[model samples]
Target chain A: AQRVTQPEKLLSVFKGAPVELKCNYSYSGSPELFWYVQYSRQRLQLLLRHISRESIKGFTADLNKGETSFHLKKPFAQEEDSAMYYCASFDNNDMRFGAGTRLTVKP
Target chain B: GAGVSQSPSNKVTEKGKDVELRCDPISGHTALYWYRQRLGQGLEFLIYFQGNSAPDKSGLPSDRFSAERTGESVSTLTIQRTQQEDSAVYLCASSFPPGPQQFFGPGTRLTVL
Candidate 1:
């Protein structure tokens, strides 16, 4: 069975500080990883995908097959970046999301 | 221009009753998915529809949960004899193909008492 693990339930950081949301997965074959963010009163939207290897909103994630981890990172956090972040992966033709990490960037 | 949309943003129902939640996927999207999120838990995959393939019910928790999609457009999830544990936010998402990136809906918050 494919499983995704996000250890942090909540993370707090000051503005301008670097942020990293940890994520790990267990799958038999190659997996596709994605990071989705949901702001207050907004729908969940895709932030980035490992396959694309492109940063969105200044966030990037690299898939490490050996460690089975794909962590999302940002050079500097912003107040507006505060939101619920979910790490997900494709499994059995469907996507599975993590428990989610609520990030709070204090000004 | 519209993203995925779900009807009845909020619903409150009594136990032992049934509820049907509807979802309208983005036009031209060939894949639709249904997920449930508990109060403070991760999203649970309930069902999925891709093109004309048979719906995948592998993630469904029990036989009480069933879902149907009409030709890759609109989808509806029905829960019979709802229980307190069934109370959660039901989210709908659509993607261009089978799976890659998905666009999510506002979700239907179902509360059972």
Candidate 2:
């Protein structure tokens, strides 16, 4: 079965500090990678997909086939950046999501 | 335009009872998906509906769970003999066909006591 792994369940960072949400997946025939986020009371929404190769809200993720990783990164964290982030893999009619990482950006 | 809508934002039921959750996808989205999220866990995809084709029910936990989509429009997921373990937020999402990105609904919180 295809799987996505997010090593950190919770991560805390101070404002102005850089943030990275680690995501790794077991590749099975070129799966698409995605990052989804859920704000405090908002619905989960698509942050970015690897295919797009574009940054959203100052966050970017690179799909590394060699590392099987698609880590979300932001140079400087902000309070609004605190949310639940999930990494997902979809391929071969199978979609697997990581357990998610709760990021807390302290001021 | 409405992104995606789910009925009965919350539902509480007793064990062994059945519950039906409804989802109304975006206007022209051809793909719809149902997922279950336990507290502090990732999405457990339950089913997928794409246009009028056969849905991918591979992620369904058991035969007691079944879903139907009304020709790329409204979808309903039914859970029979609900167990306490089934308590979770049932989320619905939709996207254009051949596109893997999804837009999610607010979710239906189901508590099976």
Candidate 3:
């Protein structure tokens, strides 16, 4: 079975601190990984995708096939960066989402 | 252009009642999707619609749940005999054909009493 796991329910960090939100997945075939963020009073939006190899809002995630992980990272955390983040994998016509991690950046 | 939109931002329904949730995908988007998010949980896929092709309803949890799309534009999810477990936020999303990126709507918060 395909599954996505986000071990942390909440992660808190101070401004200027580095942040990492862990995500892991189990799948048999090639996986398409994505990071989605939802800000307060805003709709859920795509943060980044592994295929594009692009960073959004100073956040980047690298898919590590060895450990089956796609952890999102930011060198410097900001208050504006605080939001609920979800990791997802697209399998054929189905998409599996992790439980999600809520990040809080305090000043 | 406007993003995907879902109707009834909030709905309070009695248990055993029927309710309908609507979604309007972005214009020209060929793929539409429905998902459920219970409090403190991640989004759960419920169904998918692509163009005029038959919809993939495999994610639907039970026969009480059904959805239909018209001409690749508007879609509606109907739930019969709502249960307390049915209380959740129903989200709608759309993406361009063959595109991996999906845009989500604000979602409808359904409360079953």
Candidate 4:
């Protein structure tokens, strides 16, 4: 069975501190991984995709096929970056999402 | 120029009653999807409409749930004899065919008493 796992339900970090939100997946085929974020009172939006290999809002995610991980990382956490983040994978006709991780950046 | 839209932003219904939720996909988008998110839970894929055909219905929880899309535009998801388990936020999304990025609409929060 294809599955996406987000091990942390809530991650708290101090402002200016580095943060990482871990995501791992189990799939038999080549995986297309994406990171989605939902800010308070805002609709969910795409953050980035592994294929693009681009960073948004100073955040980046590296997809490591060897470890089956696509962990999102930010060199320095910002207060405005606090939000709910989800990792997702698309396999053929089905799209699987991991339970989101709530990141709280404290000032 | 509007994005995907969903009707009845909030719906409160008594258990055993039927309800219908509507979704209007972005114009010219050939792929539409519906998902259910219970409180604090990950999104659960309900159904998908690619053009006028649904190639996958395996994610729908049960027969109590049904959906239809006409002219590859508006779609409706109806639940018969709604149950407490049916209470969730129903999210609608649309994108171009074979596109990996999907735009989401403000979800409909359904409450079943």
Among the numbered candidates, top TM-score falls to 3
Each model's chain A TM-score: 0.97, 0.97, 0.98, 0.98
> Per-residue alpha-carbon lDDT of model 3 for A20-74, expressed as tens digits?
9999999999889999999999999999999999988899999999999999999
TM-score of each: 0.97, 0.96, 0.98, 0.97
Model 3 spans > 4 angstroms off: none
Model 1 clashing residue pairs (backbone): none
Q: What are the lDDT figures for the candidates, one per model?
A: 0.93, 0.93, 0.94, 0.92
Docking class of 3: medium
Off by over 4 Å in 4: none
lDDT of 2 by residue, A1-107 (tens): 78899999999999999999999999768999999999999999889999999989999999999999999999999999999999999886577799999999999
**Best by DockQ, which number?**
1
- Give the chain B TM-score for each candidate: 0.97, 0.96, 0.97, 0.95
lDDT of 3 at A64: 98
Q: Pick the candidate with the highest lDDT.
A: 3
Q: Return the DockQ of model 2.
A: 0.78
Compose the digit string of candidate 1's lDDT tens values, residues B1-113. 39999988999999999999999999999999999999889999998899899988888999999999989789999999999999999999999877858889999999999
Off by over 4 Å in 2: none
Instruction: Name the DockQ score for candidate 1.
Output: 0.88
Classified by CAPRI criteria, candidate 1 counts as: high
Tens digits of per-residue lDDT for model 3, B1-113 = 58999999999999999999999999999999999999989999999999988999989999999999999789999999999999999999999973558999999999999
Candidate 2 C-alpha error for residue B27, in Å:
1.2
lDDT of 1 by residue, A1-107 (tens): 77899999999999999999999999998879999999999999989999999999999999999999999999899999999999999855857889999999999
